[model samples]
Every structure is written in C-alpha cells, then in structure tokens.
Target: MPSRSCPRLALLALAATLALASPPAARACSVCGCGDPQLDASDPAAASGRFRLQLASEYLSMDAGTEGAPGSTDHLKQVSLRADAVWSPAEWLSLLARVPYVRKDLTTTGPGAQGPGSSLSGLGDAELGARITLLSRVDLGRGRSHGLALTGGASLPTGSNDARRGGERLDEHGQLGTGSFGPYAGLHYAFSQGDWYAFASVTGRFHTVNGFGYQYGEALLWTAEAQYRLGQRVAVSLGLDGREAWADLDHGLAVESTGGLVLAASPAAYLSVGGGMWLGVRAQLPFYARLRGEQSVGPVLVGGVQYQAL
Candidate 1:
C-alpha cells in the first residue's frame, strides 16, 4: 500500500534540498528589472487570475580588475529583497508593482585600492507596470493553450543616488538608484500543452541622464524557458537568458567598462506548497560574456514565495 505520509515527506525533502543547494543569482540585471517578471511558478499569469503576490530574494558577487591583468583585486557583493504584486481586475489586463530593498558591499585590493571599500543598504527603484493580453487561445478539456502579452512600465527615481563613503560620493554603480527615470517595454509569450510549458520574452530599458550628468547604459534583454510539470505539485525549468547593454555616457562621452553582452543558462524548480502558495529557486550560470572593458561578472541566485487566487 502507498503510504499517506510519502507525499508529505517528498515535499519536505525537496524544500530542504532547494534551500541548502541554491546559490546566489537573480532573475534580471543587478540594478534593474531587465528580464523575466514571473516568479515561483510556471504559467500562473496564463490564468488571467484576480491577484498574485510574491516576495523574492537574490544574491550576486562580482570581481573587477584590469583587462588581461594577472590578478583581480576588487570584489562586490549584492543582496536584494523585493516585493511584487499584480492585480487583474479584468481577464485581459493586469496591473503590477515592484519594490525592492538592496544592500551592497565592495572590497578593493592592491595599491590603488581606496580604504578597503564601501557599503550601502537602502531602498532601490520601484516599478509600476501593466500587462495587456493581446492574444489568447484556451483548450480546457485538452489542457492546451497559448497566450501573448504586452508589458510596459517605468522605474521611479525613489532610491538614494548620492550615497557617500569617507565624504566622497559613491559612483552611480554603487548607489541604490540612478536618480533618473527609466522606461521599459516588452512582449511575453507562453504556450502550454498537458504538463509541459514554454515561455519567452523580450524587454528593453531606456535611461536618462541623472543630476550629476551621468547616464547609465540602455539595455536589451531576452529570455526563453521550458518547464515540465512533475505530477500536480512540482515543476522543473531550464532556460536561457541574454542581455546586451550600450555603453554608459559621462557628460556625453562614452564610459568604458560599462556595457557588454552576456548569456547564461538557468535551471529552476518550483513546488506547490498547498493553499495557493508556491516556493521556487533559480540559478543563473553565465556561459559567455563579451564585455567592452575590464570587469568580471558572477553567477546569480534567486528564490521566492508566491501566493495567488484564481
């Protein structure tokens, strides 16, 4: 006879494994929401449900040094906590908001290093957006469907931009916000048949000059993922993420080491914890990078809890 406790034990084991084995990663760029927007589940947005709420955390570590230089010297670590909410008052439209808290620490080495490093923690930029379903085809009986959505949003200049260390203002990269508004637009598509699902998205973020006459680079991001449901409670996903950023501008001059292209492979798992709740973890491993200048990027890890009602 099948034990009643078997399912419960499996759930606990999977949860524990994910918590312990997950590393540091993120769903998007470290400073911007430049990639996938869904969290903790596959195709939740496909339902056009009433509301969804998610809380997520991400970690990343970076090391920087001179290009071709024998040894790297500077290191940076970042942690972010975010809250995302979506309200779908109608079947075709959904309004969304995202808010984040960020903590950063930089460590410098070598003779040129300045006083060890700098650290800052505070609120990051907030985003408000809306998603409109442009196309939808449903087959409830056969469990097959197709969905297409258009997403548009803007990032508010709400976080600190003039953070300082030892009386010197931190650079734009070190601050929590850009102090300038950022606008983004994207398209998302999803297809589901039986227990298999696939998703793809393309997004672009545009930036403007800040108070200090510094402008961060504009970015283009894309993602594609395939998910397989393991029975009713568990799902696994594999995906590819790609990003390309234009060079930054300093008072109208190109800033080196500020933009590049990166491609990564992501593997993720999600589990339904009952009562409309789901838990998920994803790891992004960069397999290729073509940076314009001397800088080293690192892997990112992210985990989240989500609740939704349909």
Candidate 2:
C-alpha cells in the first residue's frame, strides 16, 4: 500500500541513518593549546618512570663601578629560592636536582660607602646536577623539534663571607657568598610550530675563591626566548638575558666586567585549583645593567608551582 517508489526508498533510508548518528567536530587548538613545534629532549614529560616537581622565586639587583671609584657606586640585592627534581631514567635520560636560597644586600655610594649600611644573609650557594640529551626534536618531524643538553655542576659555599662594610671584613668582591668552589655548564635549544616557540641558552661559571683574595674566576650566561600560544591553555613569553663576570686580581688586575638585561613574562596554563598546580608566572625587568661600570634599574618578581604524578 505504500509505493511511490516505496516512499522514495524510505526517504533515502532515513537520510543514511541521520548521517551515521552525527557528532564529530571540535579541534581548532587544544591539546593543552597546541603549538608544539618540536625540540623536546625531555623536561616536559617524555615517558619512562616520569616525575617532576618545581618551585621557584628570584629577584636580583645591581649597580656597580668601583675598581678605583669611577663615580663610586656598588649596590646589590639578591633574593632567590628554587627547588627542583626530575627523573626519567630513559627516553633520553633525565636526572636533575636543584636547591638554592640566597639573600644579600650591599651598598656603596659616592666615596664607596666608607661609613655605614651593609647587609648579607644566609644560605646562598648550592647546586648539583646532571642532564643528557644528545639529539631530539621529537625525533625529527611532526612540527620542528631539536634538542641537545649537557650539564655538570657544583656550587656550595653556604653563605656569608664575613659580611661587613665600614668596619672591614667584606672582601671576595664584597662578600655575601662565593667563598669558592663553583663549576657549571649549560646549553639548551628549542623550536616549535603549532603555537610557536623559540629558545636558546648558554651558561658558564667557574670559580675557586678559597683565600678570598680573588685570583681565578669566570661567569658568562646568555639566554633568548620567544613564545606564543593562546588556546589550549594559554602561553606568552619574551626574554633576553646576558651576563659577563670575569676576575683575575692578584697583581696583574685588569679583566673585570659585569653585565645584565632581562625582560620576561609567562602567564597562564599553570593553574591547579587545589592539591597542586600553578605552574607559571615569571616577570622580570631590568632595562639595562652593568657592574664594573656602574648602572641601575629594577623590577623582579617570580612565582611558581608545578607537579606531576599519575
């Protein structure tokens, strides 16, 4: 009784079963926001055993020019607290440990502050590490990735090296720490594509102060960063860092230089409502800075929180 071509083949089989039951569309970006260009030698989860935890805070200030008093000025204030631990055991190997606490304040204006005001606090130097990743950019394909990591470290003097001012003491470049024994090395490179990212790093520190008379020393640090990703979770970063500290004063004197500049920001995606999470927020400002030549500018703030266990 129903034949008009069987009601047009039952309305084309009910429109092919309503297009196979619908549902399937959503992906503009969200895999934590997605920008993953590549270069993951690890650090941000690479499998094997896995474990990560970090907490950080850093603030540093400086103004210098006092070898023989070019205009007389030496002021520095530093506060830092950092704790980190990572373990991967394979997938490129990962094992790093960090612990730091520093507080120092030194001031010398005009006649080299030959009269008052000087301060220095406790626990300011401690480091021990290991990181190895010879090649990785997520194995080469998938976006654009690359990785090379090598670090060997040692730094421990505790803090306070007499710490005084108008009453003597204070040597070792005006003590607050650095009683000697410091060795460091670092290098990292990264590039991403999905959300965009770029990074570069170099670090070096070699010191052996022992007698506090100054003789052998070295310090060089450089960093560059760029990031953009406003989606899966949120990401934004801009950075430039520089430093040069060399010393060899015994009789020959000469070599001495200090430098600085760091502007940074990374806000969002580090949020964990309760038991853990709040992984990002780093703001730093230091328009330009110099040490053996004296100059000053300020702004430094840091916040942190990161945890993973599953």
Candidate 3:
C-alpha cells in the first residue's frame, strides 16, 4: 500500500504482458499479439489506467504447392483496426481488453482459391484478459530492473464462422472467427538496464470445436526479443518467435496439412510522438517451417499508430 510500491508492481505486471505481446509468431493463431502492447509505455501523462489504441495494416501471402494436394495455396491481404486498453486499477493487478475489425480478401491459386474462397469483413473475435504481478521489479539506481508476471484470458466467438457465397462453404481459414471459444495462458520474464532490454515469454491457447464440428488445433507459442532505446523517442526491436501446433480435426478426422512447427524472425521500430502518442512498423518472416504436409507459411507486414494516456 506504499506510494512507491505502485510503479514497481505495475512493472511486474508488465513483465508478463510484454512477453507474448511484442512480435507474436506467424502461425500463433489465437495467441498472436496482433495488437501493440508497448504502444504507450512510460508516458508521463499516463499515471495509471493507461490506454493504447493501434490501427494496423497487415498482409500475408502463401505459395502454390504440388498438384493432387487436397488444399491449394492462398494469399491474404487484410486491413485491421485493433484497440487495446490497459487499466491498472491496483498496483498488483491490471486488466486488458482487445478488439479488432478485420477486412481480409482471400485469393486462391490453382484449385483452392477458385472455389473455396470468400471475403471476410467484420469484427474479429474480441479478447478479455488480465495480468497479475507475480514478481515486482527491484528498481536499482540508474534504471536497472528485473520483473516477472502471468497472464490469463479468453476469446469470445464474436466473428462469423459460417460465411458462404453462392451456397458454397468457405474454407475455415478464411472465416473471421472459429465459431468457438478459447482460453489463453502465458508467462513473461524481462530484464532491462539503461537503454537496453530483453524479454521472453511462453503462451498457450486451446480451442474447442466450432459449429461445423471442426477444431483448428491447439497452439504453443514462444517469443524472445532484444531491444535498444535510441535517445528518448525511438526504440528498435529484434525478435525471434516459434510455434508448435497440433493437427486440426474435422468430424473426428485429422486434417493432414493443418499443423506443424514454424520459426520466424521479426524486426520493429517505434517512434514516440509528443502527448503520449507513438508510431510503429514491424514485419514477421518465417525462416524455417516444418509443416505436416504440403502447407506453407509466409510473411506478415504490420504498420500501426498508437496512443497512450488517453
């Protein structure tokens, strides 16, 4: 209950929140940090109850595979508006909520996009979550710190899953949501010294079968990032991410090309603007992909503007 303990406790909660939030893996699905978390970090105007809003444009495209495969290649071009609010009602706890609006166009190549394609434009699944400070930071002089935290949350099935065009069902991948609820848990650890900082996190998400009696499989995601602050307004981050996914199931049958493991690298830059505002851009590229079948993964580009203390 001491006045100085509040900021240290908030720093502990941040350790967990920043772990899985900076550059999520490319195939993390429900566990990806598609919204920016560090968007309004450490703004003097943001004493408590900080809010960060990010609107980003993201794009990803796949490659064509061999013939006779059950699925064909597809490319996704999307524009999404994501909003994240961070409220520190108590020093030892924080509440977070994220909502996104996605407009994605799927273009099929070869046989896949020719028939099983559909456009999705609507509200994506919204997530409500909270972070607890398991370990508060010890703020030594000269800005040295260490902290840890834990996070738990769930996603609501707000997006439509049964989207059809001309009486044909679109692919599950193209749907705005899985039509199923999911739960997420994660842990974070971070260390910072002066202008240099590093963080790591492990996150897991499990999903249930959707309305079509199909499940997209569970995912375990890992992330690590090293960053350096430039002057007072700029930060550069280099991140590595990995994901392991179980094979998807449909009608109790395993989907061959549905799951595997992927490793990716991402780099980002953030520029702080005056009045608790910032701008950022990041790219996620999969360098190693060992999928189950003939599936492939690609890169994602995200550009966003964020605000805090609002």
TM per prediction: 0.84, 0.28, 0.82
Per residue, candidate 2 scores C-alpha lDDT tens digits across 1-310 of 1222211121111110100010000010000011111112223333468665666665655555655666776666666666666656676666655555656666677865576546665665555565677666553345455666665556566665666556677634445555666666677665554455555666675666465455443555555656554443334556554444454444446433333232222222223333324346544444444344344445555565655443
Each candidate's clash count:
4, 12, 1
| Candidate 1, poorest ten consecutive residues by summed lDDT | 16-25
Candidate 2 segments whose C-alpha is farther than 4 A from its true place: 1-115, 118-133, 137-141, 152-167, 171-181, 185-191, 198-209, 212-226, 229-282, 285-310
Worst 10 residues of 2 by lDDT: 22-31
Tens-place lDDT per residue, model 3, 1-310, is 1223323222222221222232222223333342223322322122345555545555555432322345555555555666666676655566767677877676677654466456789998887777666886656675666767786787789988888888877767667877988787778676766556767777787788888998867877777777766656666777787777787778888765556777778777777566655677777677887776666566666666665543
Would you list the rank order by lDDT, best first? 1, 3, 2
How accurate locally, in lDDT, is each candidate?
0.66, 0.46, 0.60
**In what order do the candidates fall by TM-score, top score first?**
1, 3, 2
The model with the greatest TM-score is 1
RMSD of 2: 22.2
The reply for model 1, stretches above 4 Å from the true place, is 1-29, 32-34, 37-49, 65-73, 139-142
What TM-score would you give candidate 1 relative to the actual structure? 0.84
